[model samples]
Target chain A: MGALPELSVDIGGLKIKNPVIAASGTFGYGDELAPFYDPSLLGAIIVKGLSLRPMPGNPPPRIVETPCGLLNAIGLANIGIEAFVGEKLPSLATIKAPIITNIYGHTIEDYAEMARRIEGVKGIAAVEVNISCPNVEQGGMAFGRDPDSAARVADRVVENTTKPVIVKLTPNVTDIGLIAKAVEAAGAQSISVTNTFLGMAVDVATRRPKLANMVGGLSGPAIKPMALYLVHEVVKAVRIPVIGLGGIMDYHDALEFLLVGARAIQVGTANLVNPKAAIEIVNGLTDFCLREKIKDINEIIGALETKGEDHEKKGDRKDKSKANF
Target chain B: MDKSRYPMVEEVVSIGFNREIGKDTFLMGFPCVALTSRAKPGQFLMIQVDRQAKDPLLRRPFSIHGVLDSNRLMILYKVVGKGTALLSALREGDTISAIGPLGNGFTLPGPGERALLVAGGMGIAPLFFLTQVLTRAQNHSVKMFLGFPTSQDVVLIDQLKGLGVDLSLTTEDGSLGIKGLVTDLWDQTLSQESTQKPVTYACGPASMLKEIAQKAIARNLRCYVCLEGYMGCGLGICQGCAAKAAGSKDKPYYYVCQDGPVFSAEMIDWEVM
Candidate 1:
C-alpha cells in the first residue's frame, strides 16, 4: 500500500538507483542485452574490459562448462579505449543508469594511460580498474596478487583520473584482507571483491586441456560460498564500500551478498545464463522489501546478525583454520 | 549484425513433440509463433534444458531446423554431450525457456541462380529450412547433397524427399546412395554444371565446410556457410565463439553468434579455422 522501497545506494561518491550491477565481460558493450531488457533498469552497466589497443583475445575453446561453473580464458578482448569512447559511449550515455567503464592493461603505464584517456568522458560515471584478470599472462593478476602492486595500480589510476576508482580484486591471493586495506589507503573510492578464480579442465579421451589456454578463470555458482567469505573479510578490513559478486544468480544470492556488508552486488555468469537476470533481481529485491515491510533496501545492507554465542565460537573456529593455513 | 531486422523473443514455449528421428538424434518441436514467424533459415535458438539445475549452467545453441504448421518451431539435435543427453529426456507438454531468432541467417539466393545446398551428418538441420524456402521461390532451381557417416545416421529422408528438390545422398560405408564424402557429390555437381550460375550454402563440420569453401572460392562462386561454436550467450555478449577473419590483420576475430552463424565463405580465414 505504501510507496515502493527505496533501492538506491552509493558506491563511494558514484550514486546508482539500485545495488544490482551487470558485471564486466558477461554484459558486452551494454548493447547485447538490449534485445532482452532495457539496460537502464540496473544500478550500473560495466562494459567488457578494454585496453590501449584492440585485443584479438585467445584462440578457440575459450569457454568450457564445469560443474555449476564456467571456465573462460577470453584474454581481455576489447576494441580498445578509443573505440569504446568513440563508438559505444555515445549510445550508452543516453541510458538512465550510470555507465562504468572496465579497463585492463599489460602494464602499470597501460592502466594509467587508460585512466587518462577516459578522464573527461561525458557518459562514464566511474572506472573499474581490472588488476585481477587471470586469463591474461601479464599485468592482470600480476598486479593484484601482492599488496604493494595492487596499491600501486590503484594509486596510479586515482592520480590519472578524476572519476571514482573502484579497484576490482582477485581471489587467487594469499591474504585478500591485506590487499583490500592497501588499495583503500592508496585512494581507491571502493572495492569490488573477487574476480574469477584460476582453474583448468582436461579432456580424458584426447589427453588434452579443454581450453586452448590450458587454464582459465572459473566463475558461476560453484564459487559463490568462497566469494561471499572473501567479501565478508574485505568489508571488515576496509572502510570503503565493497561490491560483492561471484555466481550471484537471483535475488536470494543478491541478498546474501548485501547481508554480508556489501554495498552492491554484481551478476557475472548469471548474465550469460539469463540475460534478464539483473532486472529480475532488482524486481525481487523490491518484492522482498514490500513483503517484509522494510522502508528502504539499505536496512538490509550489512544487517547480518551474529549475536549468538554459537556464532561467535564459529567465527573463532574459522580464525583458527586460517591460522592453520 | 543489424539486430533490429529480427527482433529477438525470449519465451517459455511448450513442447509439441520430442521424438527421435535417428540414432542418438532428435527432432523436437514447440509451438512458438513468435519465433517461427520472425526466424530465418540459418538463425539459432538458445534453449535452457534444465531450469532447476546449475550443472549445465549455460543454454545450448541449436540452429532452427524447420517450421511446421506456421506456428511450431523445430530443432534437430544430436546427442553428443551432457547437454544434448539432458535435452533428449525432455517430453511433450513440458516447458523450456528459449531465446531466439538470434544471429544473422543465410542470405537468400537471387532469382534464376541455382541454389546448391550441402549437408554433412547433422549439419542438415538449418539447410532443411533453407531448402523449403528456396523450393517455394520462383526461378530458383534447388539441388541438395547430403552425406552421413552411416545409413543409421541418415535422417529426415521422408521429409526431405517431399520438398521436391534434386537430392543426392552419400555414406562413408556405402550403406546409402553412394559411398564417399559429400564433397565428392558436390564436386560432381560443380563439374557437371557450367551454364547455371550456382550459389553454395552449406552447414557441417569444420573440415567439410573448409573443403566446400575452398572449392567454391576456386570457382569464384558466392558461398555462404553456417558455422557452430561453443557459445555462452548466443546474443554476442559473451564473445566466446571467436572465428578468424579472412585477410584481416586489424580486426582478427568475428563472433559466430553475432557477425554470423551464417557468413560469406570469403569472409573467414580457412587456414586458421
Candidate 2:
C-alpha cells in the first residue's frame, strides 16, 4: 500500500543500500558481472581476493562442480594490491554499489600492506580480511586455527586501514564462537560468518583429487544450513554484526539468515548458477517485505522468537540427563 | 570487444529442429532474433533445458554452432553427461531459456592470408560457424581438417563440403578419409602446401589441442585454439572456467570465459596447464 520496504543495512557501520552483497571470488572485480546487471544495484560488491603482490594462484582444473556444491581452489589468484588501486579501482568507481575489497596475505605485514593500500581508495566501503583460504601454502586456514593468530591478523589489518574491517572466518575451526570473539577483540568492525568449508572430492576414473590443489573450499547450497548455524552462534557470541553466507540461493535463504541473527547476507556459489542471483535476491527481499507488510526490513533481523514449549523441552532434556547421571 | 554491444538476451526460444546428426551428437536449432543476429563464431550460450529441476542448478554452456538466418541459431553437441543428455531429450518446439552472445569471439585471419581449421568430434560446432564467417570474406583461402572416431561419429560433412573450401576428414579406424588422427592429415597438408605460412584455428579435446600445438610449434606457425572446461556461469564472473595463461615471468590464470574460449596457441603453457 505504501511505497516499499527499506532494504538498506549497516553491517557494524559499513552502510549498504540493501542486505544482498555479492560474495568474493564468485563475483570478480565487478567487471564481467556488470554486463548481467549494474552491480551498483547490489548492496555491496566484494572483489576477488588480493595479496601484497600478484599471486598466480593454483594450477588448472581449479574449479569442479559436484552435487549442489562447487569446489574451488583458486589459491587467492589476484593482480596484487597495487594493480587494484591503479587499474581496477578506476573501473569499479563507475558502479554505484559500495566496494569491499577482500584481502589475503601470507604474513601480518602482507595483510597490513594490502589494507593500507586499500585504505586510501575512494569507493571502498571496507576491507574483508580473508583468513580461511585452504588452497594456499601459507596463511589461509592456518591463521584461523588459533585465536591469538586470528586476533593479531585482524588487529594488524584494522591498525593499517582507516576504513572499517570485516573479518571473514573459516568454518574449519572447532569453536567458531571463540574465533568470532577473538576478531571482535582485535577491533574487527564486523565478521562474515563461515567462509567455504575445506573439502576434497576425488574422481573415481582418474584416482586423483578433483581440484589440482588436492583440496578446495566448498561453497553452494550444500553448506547453507551449517553456515547459518555458525552465523547464529557467532551472533550470540559477539556484539558486532554478522554477515551470513555460504550457499544462499534465494530470498528465503537470505531471510532465514537475517531472522536467525545475521545483519546482512551474501550470495556465493549461486552466482555461478545464476549470474543475476544477488540482484534477484535483492528484488525478492523487497517483494517479501511488500507481501508481509513490513516497513523496515531490518525488523526481521534477529527476530527469532522462542516459544515456551520449546524452551521447556530444552530444560526438560537437560534435567533428564542430570537425573540419569 | 565491448561485450555489452552484443546485448545479452535471455528468453524462451522455440526449437526449430532437433535431430541426431552423428553418433552421440545432435544439432538443435532455435529461433531467437536478438541473440542469433549478434552471435560471433566463438561465443557461447548458457542454456537452461531442465527448467523445472534444480539438482542441475546451473545452466549448460553451448557454443554457437551455426546461424541459420537472422532469426535462428544452432547448437551442435554430443551427449557427454547429465546436462547434455537432458539437452538431447528435447523435441522440436520445446522452449529452453538461453543467455547469450556472451564472450569474445575468434579474431578472423587477415585478408589474403591462408586459414587452416582443425577440429575433433563435437568441437566442430564453432569451427562450422567460423568457416561460414571466413567464406563470406571471400579473400582468404580456407582449408578444413576434421577428425572423428569412425565414419559413424562423423557429422556436418555435407554442410562443410558445400562451403567451397579445401575440406578433408579423417577417422581413427580407417573408416573415413585418412587412417590416422587429423594431425596426420594436417602434417601432410603442411608438407605439400604452396601457401605462405597460413594461420591455424582449432577446437577439440585437450589432448588433441596439445598435439596440434606441438605440430604448430615445430612448423613455427601461429595457431588459435578454442578450449572448453566445466563452466558454471559462462558470464566469466564465476571464474570457474579458468585456463592458465603462460605469462612471461608472471603466469596468471585467465578466465577462459572472459579472456577467451579462444586464445593464441603459444600463449597457453600446455606443459603446466
How big an interface RMSD has model 1? 2.9
Q: Where is model 2 more than 4 Å wrong at Cα? A: A309-325, B1-7, B50-53
lDDT of 1 at A304: 84
Kindly list the per-residue Cα lDDT of model 1 for residues B1-273, writing each as its tens digit.
244654897889998899998999999999998899998999999999766579888998999998988999999999998898988998998889999888899999888888999999989999999998888775798999999999999998889889888899999999988999999889888998987769999999999999999989999999999999989888888888999899889878889998999999999999987
TM-score of each: 0.96, 0.93
Chain A only: TM-score of every candidate?
Answer: 0.94, 0.93
Cα displacement (Å) at residue B230, model 2: 3.1
Backbone clash count for every predicted candidate, in the order shown: 0, 1
- Model 2 has a DockQ score of 0.44
Q: Give the CA lDDT, 0 to 100, for residue A63 in model 2.
A: 80
Q: Note the residue pairs that clash in candidate 2.
A: A40-A97
Give me the displacement of residue B100 in model 2, in angstroms. Answer: 2.4
Per-residue error for A267 in candidate 2, Å, reads 1.2
